[model samples]
Target chain A: MPKPMLKRSVQQTQTNNVLSVTGNQKQNNQNQQMNKMKIDKLLRQKRSKEYMDALHKLDVGGHVHNQNKVDEITNAIKREFPEVEISGILLGYVSICYLGKPYEVHTLDIASGIIEHYKSGETLPNGMEKARGIALHGGYEFIEVYVDCCRAVSSNGTVSVISI
Target chain B: MSDRVISQANLSYIERNLSAIHGEIQALENDVDAVNNNVKVVYDQVGVLANEFHEFVYEQKKANRLGQAEIKLVQIRQELEKKYGHYDIVRRTTTGILQADDLGIVKKTTISNATEELMISTPNYWLAPCLVALSAWISDQPELAEKALREGIKRNDEKTSLFFAIICMRANRKSACLKWAQRYLANQDEENLDRKAIIVIDAYANGLMGADTEGVISREMTKWLEELAEKPGFVEQQTTQWTEAINLKREPIENSGYTYLPKYSNTWPVLEDILEGANLHANILAYLMDIFEQESSSAPIKAQLDKILTSLVTDFDDEELPLRKKEKFEQFVVEFCGDEDRARQSMAIEETAFETHKDFTQLLTDAAMKPESSHASVATQKFAIALSKEWILNAYNDVIAQNRMKIPTEIEINVDTFNSKTTDGQNEAQLVNEFTQLVTKEKEAALAKNVLTGFDKFLLIGGAIIAVLGVGMIFGNPLGGFIAVIAGIGMVIKHFNKKKQLVINEENIKKNYEQKLENGLQIIRAILAEVVDFRIEFAEKDDESAKVVDFLEQITPDQYVKNLSTSNRRIKM
Candidate 1:
């Protein structure tokens, strides 16, 4: 009697399990996958944030070392390409090659900013170095060594530069 | 009277002459008054006579004399009518023989009889006899045709031959047309070809004369070419002609094509030469294509034949030139109410059309270029171009040589410090990569030169050496050792400061190198782009010579006949 009762109990448990598994299983499975995807995305974001924070620390140290370099580039731009600080790259080649001079001193400074056009093609040589060039890109351009940098300006003021 | 005169001459010369002159003056005055009175008396008598003369002269007799004068004027008008009136009959009959369904000689005697009557009335008119013969031939009266044709030839053989050529062509009598054309060409010298010969040639070249199956007409034209081409400096003359013609097709090149080359390169002149030379190929092809692509002239045969016959009748023969001139002057005088000056001015305005002669080669070019002005059809233009293809080929080859000579082997890229050249522009990526490596080496050299290196290491080593020496000195001489220690300390401080300066210098160099590398790379790449365009355009245009050759190669007589399929359907009766 005890053996039969145990088997009967096991059968009842199996049937209940089958009904529960079939009923609402599709809905429950979708909910489980969605929750798992959300958890995984959050973990990835947390990892990426930690990684970026580490990278930012490294970049900060690099900036501290190159602080003088940035200042030096700014002074060079003031000396060679004075207006490039305010004007955009449309006037770059013309400013460098102005006055029919094929070669000119190229000192450049670039900071992230929206591009604005310099309509006047006017340029003045200010304490320009002789016989050397610092390649200018985006806003300042004057340097030419043995290679050419091809560039295109989109309508929305984005300058796409490709070095060949 | 002699004695009285002698007595007056014998008196004092001056006084005697004066007195005699006064007496003569009085006598002349008296005579004038006497004549005035006599004029009055005669006027009164004439008035009386005028009244009686109407009674004496009969009205019927006056009318009879006036009628006789007008009758003589009518005869003069009939003579004038020969030029304007009777020629219409002959021309209409001749044109009708081709267009009218019936030779109509037996059924419709009206026009043929009128043309026959013109031969008798206008005996000296060359076309009159020719038209009579053409009519008789249409009537199948072979005997009558022969006699009148003999008369027509004797009068003006050239006109007779041209007349029959056009007539036979219009009649669709292929053999007779060729024979007549050969007869006309036989009498022609190249220098003195008649305008009518040009018309005949236009017809022949247009293939309006149907399929010249025997090629006899082509042989005749070839003979004319052989003779003309054999002349001194003929080839040279043709070369000059074609050179001018081809040179006209060349257009001025605009500066907008090459954006950078003009600014940076001195190689612009050579580049311009090649570019313009290439442009000529497109221009020449487009010019020919514009003509060839036009719808083939689909003028019906009757209209085309009518235009030819109209050219024949409208043009006067040399023998009838005086009569035609007289007729024109007479007509003008009548039109302008006998105003001789106005008549002469009017005649001068139309005088240029009187030139009924043309040089053969000049005619060919004129017909090709100004087809309408030279009275040429579209087919004639095509034929003229086909005929002169050899000359065009010669000139085109010369054009190719001259321009190809100027193509640069290498293009120079000049922009400030970036001065280099490229022979091959297609491998832009490889060329760019190579340029970058070269610049890197150059930048390294510059950095070595501009920025001091190894000085920091030297300073550090020197500072340690001085410190060790000071320690050793401290044992021997305390004061000296103390001073040495202080100096070493100062040296070590200076080394730190020097190392800082070195970092700044290095930063400056790196920035300069990076910027220069970027710009230089861009410059070389941009210049290579222009070179690519130049090389591609030159080769593309230069290769057009083959197309021209192919164009010329396909223009055979057999092919020309094939092209005539459309006209062939409409040409034959």
Candidate 2:
């Protein structure tokens, strides 16, 4: 009888050990699933916020950028060719030729200010310089050169430069 | 060891996939940022281009206006020259006659010899009437002049009639003068007269009579004088004689005074011719006095003549005098009083005459008020008034200039008011109104465009970013990211295309401006051509015409060359 009872006790202990191991594995799987879901949600939320911020920045930047370009063109035109009366603002990319080279100038008010020249090139400082150059050359070229300084402010408020 | 190995592999694979997704999202965000930046740049460029176009258009308008103004100025100058250039005629006549040795139709040894020979050789039937007419006219014989005129007319000899008319006019036989003048004018054909003969006839008829005729008479006289003055050969001699005459100097006679006496010798062949006349010497003296009285510088001579005329007027009774003499004397008084002061006095007479002889006064008033009559009278009167005014104004101007006086307070104030009224206040008010309308429209357009561009740029960037993030959220959304990139590129292309179209529109406007300028120049050229023709005709002299032609030539070449040069420059540019 003593021999049989010892065997039974050993079997019971083995079963209890198996059950505890299974419970521990299940708890660990649930915790891993929950952590994965939490991480995915946080990442999506961060990405959306970044996109929203970028979009807002872009909108504000566009307005500021346009305004800055106008100011730069106006200043450049005023400085280079002071005689050209500024009349009003207009919009578009205005390319002006200065000193035989073409440069693009941006302006918000075209009706108010006098544009010296038109050409295709990189950004220029003033419309008047191109006009002056054309005048000096007896209007020989297709473009006018303005001798003016322009103020440009970046949209991000990071850069401000004067072109002359 | 086996379980640990399985977990590590799975974790590593998931981490690699997540990193790839995150990389894609970053790439998409960068693409959006680039698009946004590009849109901003394009917007700025468009603004500048628009401004340049506006300036170009304005300059073109200004140039057109200036060209038009210059053309108008040229036209006005030509018109003024045409209207006022004829005043140089009177100075020509005095000089031409002063230098003539023989005032005969044909060259002769002497004017008197020619006259006597012509009178003697002519047939008695023809000669007798001409002699009587000439004698009567020279002696201011009123009844004999009428009889002589009638006899000449019955014979129907135009040449003799013309001679009688000229003589009668010179003698101041106003009635006989008018009758013969009317008869001669009625018989004459203008086409038959050469310019020189016409000039001589005009000078004799108009200049000697001092008729105060206007229109064709005055115009022709002025034209003749202008032509004569411009002749280098005649100008100096004529001007010198005029100055001498005006200064009351004894002018040199080309022939001795008696040598030319034969012109009147035939008419006085018998003692009866001189003695049987009605105070022939007194008539000659009276005629001379009449001519001198109107133009005399000596006040006493004018006063004496006035007294004589006044006495004659008071002494003569209208019914008691012979009909012919009464008619002749009345015509003389009417003509004499037709001068400037007389005209003013006659206005009062006109009003009184209207009351007593209403029918006659109405007829006379109607004649005076007629446009043709006013045209004839007003032209001369205005010219005289203008001459007097110009003289006074010039003298006043000289005084003002010499004194260096400040402008009068009244004038200064008026000028200030005029400037402010016409220029500052008026123009500013107009400009403000126009500008307000323009700005409101333009600003609205600009704002709309700006917002649209901003929204488009934002959408392009935002969509790309969102697509990239979505792809990362899903396992691998490559298709979505690819679609976003395509849309962004399309948006950029669309924006660029829009900008290009705007540039084209601006170019079209510039082209239109150039076309308008060309059209305006053509109109100006046409106007200038008309002015040139008018100036040439108006100048009416060989030398003046030549000078005008030269001036026109100079202007034409310069204008044509300027136009060609500008066109060539435009092509080159």
iRMSD in angstroms, per model: 28.0, 38.1
Would you estimate the TM-scores of all the predictions? Answer: 0.51, 0.20
Of candidate 1 chain B, the 10-residue stretch with the lowest lDDT total is B564-573
At residue B213, give the lDDT of candidate 1: 78
In order, the B-chain TM-scores come to 0.63, 0.23
- Alpha-carbon runs more than 4 Å astray in model 2: A1-164, B1-152, B157-159, B166-434, B437-441, B453-573
Clashes of each: 15, 40
DockQ of every candidate structure: 0.00, 0.00
lDDT of 2 by residue, B111-163 (tens): 23433344344333343455454444334466865675576566655545554
Tell me what fraction of the real C-alpha contacts between chains A and B each candidate also makes. 0.00, 0.00
The CAPRI-style docking tier of model 2 reads incorrect
